[model samples]
Target: MSRRQSELEGRLDDMLSRIAMETQEIKELEQQLTDGQILANEVLQRDLEGIISGLQEYLRGLRDQARRSQQQVDSLQAENQSLQLHLEDSQRHCRQLEDRARTHTQDMSVQQEELSVLRTEAHALRDRQVESSRQQEELEVELQQLREELARQVTLGQLERGALLAAVDKEKQSTEIRECQLQATIDTLQDEKSSLQQITLRLQAQLDQTRTQYTETRDHLDQTRLQLDRFTAAMLDPQEVQSGPDDLDEDKYRYHYYNFIFQQDLAPAQTARSTKTWFDVHAITVLDWPANSPDLNPTENLWGILKRKMRGTRPNNKEELTASIKEIWASITPRQCHVASRQ
Candidate 1:
């Protein structure tokens, strides 16, 4: 770049020198013309003027060319600066490319080493494939033997299965026989159950009839007793009953007792004593009465008879006592009541 600048400067200097020399020569010629122009021909004077104009034009052209050259040099210097920057950028890019190429070369070398190792592994795998093929053939032979053995075992298994099926069939037949036996037993049990059910129904019917007869007999007995009580109470020897203020308390007690027994006065009014305590304390069937008043509440007499019977039988529990009482109560006939009433 410096050499090119120097060359351009040299050319411009040479041009300037040539222009100076030409100007000097032209000045000398002008002096000669001024000194010899009066003796010179018009042709010579015209030639001198043409020469001077030509020299002036040439000088102007040279000056213009020099100016153009200077402009061109400046342009070239700007271009050189741009090109230098571009060259530096290019150099940097080339260096990067070189670095990349070197890295690629290293990578390629490593890849080549890996490829060699892969080749060795491939060769080993190939040998292993050959060995595996041999082993596969051996295994195929073993498989054939195993298949033969398996086929034999399968035949044995089939035979065993046949035996098992036979046994299963025998077991199934035995199970069927047992089922038939069980069915027969079930039929017998069903017959027995039917007989028992018939007996139970007959017994239930008899029980119902007995309960009806008992209820009627008991109702008749109760009616008879009530009539006898009323009769006995009515036979009061025509005496005038004297009412005293103390008798009023006894009368109120009797009223409350009857009310409690009959479930009268749903929410009873509070009295001297709660009637609830009376029920908790006493049973309506059991009562305290004088000797002559025995006929007034004949249920007391029945309870006394029942208690006498219960006293002889030692019961372990209330249930047994209740059952015995219920049985004895059910056994009580109208004859028994009549006898008791007579007594």
Candidate 2:
């Protein structure tokens, strides 16, 4: 019986020892699992922090871009106002010039009329002087014939001596007085003719000077008309002068078009390709196909669409082109422009 009791105690001790070993193994596994979970949590926290930081940076960039866009839009609006003011000023100046030109033309017409009247008066005066000269010549010829007849009567000596001598003296005295008067008349007519000739010469010089001035004024008016025509054409078709840097020739690649986007502006800061003088004006934005970059180009997809609509089955000509462009520009939808702005 005592041996049976000892064997049972030994079995209970072995069972207790096995239970203690199993408990130690289980504690070690629990510690390892806890460490693994801590490491996982740390890694997850770090990843989450990195993602948030990236998102913040991205949002900051977007805000900065938006601010810059707003600034550009403000600048554009200011520029537009300035342009409108300048246009109004130019128009006012043009109107003043036109008024001045009209006044000058009217003055010229008045002067021309006065000159014509003066010329007619001088011509009539000249004709009257010519007639006076012819009449004086006839009177002089008749006086000469009378003097010859008197001399022939004196040579014949057919009357009484005292009577003939008296007649001869009387005739001599009369002839001398008539000759003196005729010479005075001739001197007076010569002076009048010289004065008329001088007046005619002065008038001719004045007429030539006026004609030259009129010619110069006409030429200036023609030049002004040409300039106005060119200005109008440029305003009507701004795209004709808008070109991209890539489309420019190699020697002119340094220049870039100034783009006026909805809320932004873009242009080259320095020459990277070539050197050439470029137009100073704003341009519309366009997208490059392969490069996927936005740029300013006058002749692009949007413009092309507008042009196509303008053409609208009509033959191309100056009149048709102008009319079509006006119509197409008026038809552009705002929603379509909004989508383009996103791109």
The digit string of per-residue lDDT tens for model 1 on 1-343 reads 4465557567766866776686567667666665456456456556866876786677677667767777988999999999999999999999999999999999999999999999999999999999999999999999999989999999999999999999999999999999999999999999999999999999999999999999999999977755554443334422312343223333223332243433222223522266656654443332333343324345655776788788889889989988999988887776767666666
Determine which window of 10 residues in candidate 1 has minimal summed lDDT. 244-253
How far residue 28's Cα lies from its native spot in candidate 1, in Å, is: 99
Candidate that would win on lDDT: 1
> What local lDDT does model 2 show for residue 296?
39
- Model 2: lDDT equals 0.66
TM match of model 1 to true structure = 0.34
Provide C-alpha RMSD values for all models, in order: 32.4, 49.5
Which one is best on TM-score? 1
